[model samples]
Target: MVHLIKTQSSSAKSRMGPASLNPDLPAVAGLGSFEKLNGFFNAIYDGPTEDPPWHSALNLLCETLHAKHVTLILKPPSPVSTGILVNTDAVAHDATEAYQNHFFTLDPFVGLPEGQVVTPEELVGDKVWKQSTLYREYLKPLDVKFLIGADIQTADGIECRFRVSRGGDIPFSADDIALCRLLLPHMRRALQLHSRLDGLETERQLFAGAVNSMQLGTISLAHNGAVIDLNPEARRILAEKDGIQISNNVLCTDNRREGHELQRLIKEALSGSAGKKGPGLVEALALTRPSGRSSLGILVKEIPPSPWTVNRQRAAAVIFIRDPEASVAETSQKIVQQLFGLTRIEAAMALSLANGSTIEETAENLGLKKNTARTYLRFIFNKTGVTRQTMLVRKLLGSVASLG
Candidate 1:
């Protein structure tokens, strides 16, 4: 017959103090109990923004509960998935590795009723638990004598497991369970916030990567025309100090006439009066480079103010700059070649022409005769279904080659 540890029911346990179960547990440090709780709650709320989210809160919980290990299974392990696991510093690397690799399936303490805290002995009879493979081979060797755990289910369908382990005879007290129960709701909310923030950050990185891959210079400006943010390509272009540069934290051109025009366009975009055509109008200009390279193409467009940000000096305008002299990425060239099934020479010629180079210039660059370049260009036109050089440039620019 299985022997079970007769513990008090949930109602009776809620009334007991921490000293009732474990009198040797350490006392709080200099701060009062209220202050410590306040700090823990703060850490919990601050977790989503932290680099390694919840590290501080988990460590504090381990200390507060006097637990040998505090493990948070953000995602539970399954037959097909290894899942996500986080542990406090008290957990050794080998113990964690072993549990994740082989013993997770055998753990009988998991899948506890959502938000209901229970010790292993309470969940499974003491005699049955001691005889189990997980107990004898995993917990016993690690000196884990007692454990308290609960499963947290978020509204977004995330199942999280919170576990606290103790090595000695002292089991978790009723006060410890009460504290965990109180914090469970907050933990659920924090995890939901973290999931949403993580998704947004991932999407931002994806779009930023696509823009950077295209070598497109993007500059975000505040309502007052101050430079708020810029992608890597914009930073590179400004760093060269060629035609466009940032002066007084605002975008400006080196040429006096072009500089005034650029400033006017930015002002128009910010003031919702592009040439008095009203808001949402786009303006374009070309800045002549001092280096005698091809002029830099610029487009300015107004950013509509959101309902909640009507009064804020947020990003009011965006400037898109493109350098005609910039060559397409080598990977993009390969993609273009594959997409059109063009010969290597033909593909190189197409990319050169797309970059605003003339057929004669491309011929000279590729060591091919002007007639041969024209022949290759004709072949490209036929294969790509474009009749004109301008059409071919539009086709290549609109293709997925830029995403390469």
Candidate 2:
């Protein structure tokens, strides 16, 4: 049986926890009920970082509170800004849109302090709530009644509000308020974790896009040489399958000698032996295709362990492949000069690199000395805030400042 006992604290008078909802009803919420809640907490973290599985977790919360519908609403600090309101039920889109567009100001529970659990009657008495336009015109038509709200958090002018509502006359009981209070901390923590994970996913996408734009193929491998991730360029290279291909989810080249060397480096990198070789030690090899296309230059390097990757087993080493035969897109020299503040010669050098020309080759094609080309490259790098040719290429290709 659930009991409510009063106890005095050093700073306050005697306070009591919530009493049972109904003494007449049997206690359905036993140890097993709490076990289910624990499961919900664990399940919230086990999914794609971009799109979290919140709907299922909300369903579990609804079951615990015996609520008809649980809705999450976010209100920006400014009235003109658009915010989000999502409901556990699918049919409330029209009602929710109306609330966002018109009735949010009339909402009795808006602007509440964080962690304050409240009910409709507490905000406005039963008579006043019934007479309000929000209740009479908007909520009554939708058959929504009896709300319990708690402000989970407010950060950077964004307020996170969570509420549970019941319909058809009966109001939320003391038990419902207590249950909401109990689960509020876990819910708030979960939302914080979700925000952090989403930020990480965004950064990962930006880095991947920059790498792909440089026309470089990047592949991440696990300790066992299993493929973990491949950028867009890597996917294209693998699709050609002239020399490099995925065999049984592991990276493999057509030539036995080079494949064996590649596997050895991967293993050595994963085992942390790569650092013993020397500083900035990277293994390089060439993949020669039988069709006589340009050879693919592959470089394998160890990724140092970090606290951010303590739980991930497959983020140990990365492979970068440069294909000499692949066609390069021509970048506009005028756009390059405007974007990077480059002189005409420097812009020419940048565009030549964008078109897959080495410094010597570009110097020969432009009828300039190699030292002149090198000097121009340094100036371009300084203007673009990069210290290396690879970074310069990445910046030029990834930037949309010159694009139509």
Candidate 3:
């Protein structure tokens, strides 16, 4: 059994009161119940940045309601297998797996009419529940005598189940059921938040992977000029200490004049005034390297506020840096030479043109005559099946050739 365990809160056990009198009628929960619940809510809200330590919260729920054991299961219908989110250690792993594989079909709670919170006693009479195979054979072996569960979600044919079970013959009181009902909304919201955060994290990882693969340095900034996050490439540039580095969590360059200019651009972008000229305007600057190598190309672009922009604390502007002296260009050259079967000179010319250079500029850069450069460009156009220079550059850039 794959158990995702989280330890219980310290106060959870102490705050939970014993089983009350009049097990059939409702009773008011204690004053300390609200404080105990606040801890669970904190875990739920923290779920996006980190996995919430929900075991403590679930343990609190079981203890608060006087249930011996509890389990929460989130599963998609049919093709997708079920997963146990939380399970109290009181139940053996083997017993849980056995119930999951075989006894699940016999569960009276499986097809209970869709409702808020329902107990076995409410769904089926105590006599009828006792007579069922689920109790006589499966649950009897596990020693679970009573159960209370809620259907949290049943969207798109996927069902999420939250259930608490008690041992021995002592039945749950009305207060236990009411407590479960009270806790249902919090549990439901936490699950939804978990799902949303999972999606956002996956997208962030995918984007980060793509950016890293291309050797593009990306730095996300807060409104106050603090560094929110930096990709691997950005870190590499900062470590080089040739041109750019992060000081005081702010982007800095070796040259004081250049640094001042960069800071001004960053501030402008953060202020949401960088695009005042038009929409989606990207401010560009170049940082001179100490080694006198190719200057690093940097672009600071303002990002409009979105639903994901939490109070504009972070992600106000994004700085994209490109290091021309890096091995990325060499890798791209190799890829172009291999894929297009071009000579080294021809490959260099093709990449240069794709990077928005004119034929004259390509010739000058490669130390070749205008006619020789034109011949190479013509050959590239023929091989790539494009007549226009613009189309040829587009083809080369769009292909896997430029991904190096």
Better of 1 and 3 by lDDT: 1
Please provide, for model 1 over 308-363, each residue's C-alpha lDDT reduced to its tens digit, 9 standing for 90 to 100: 78666678988998887777644466788899998888888888888878999999
Q: In candidate 3, which residue ranges exceed 4 Å CA deviation?
A: 1-53, 76-84, 88-109, 119-143, 154-158, 306-312, 325-383, 387-394, 399-404
Best by lDDT: 1
In order of appearance, the predictions have TM-scores of 0.76, 0.74, 0.66
> What does candidate 2 score on TM?
0.74
lDDT of 3: 0.72
| Over 4 Å off, model 1 | 1-35, 78-81, 92-98, 139-142, 222-228, 245-277, 309-317, 330-379
Local distance difference test, each candidate: 0.81, 0.72, 0.72
Candidate 2 residue runs with Cα over 4 Å from true position: 1-33, 43-53, 74-81, 154-158, 307-312, 327-337, 340-404
Error of 2 at 331 (Å): 5.6
Can you give the lDDT of residue 72 in candidate 3? Answer: 71
Cα displacement (angstroms), candidate 3, residue 249, comes to 2.5
Instruction: For residues 149-245, write the lDDT of model 3, one tens digit per residue.
Output: 7777734343578778888777766556665665666667667777776778899898787777676899999888889988888888888889888
Colliding pairs, model 2: none
Over the stretch 254-277, how does candidate 2's per-residue lDDT look in tens digits?
Answer: 999988988888888888898899
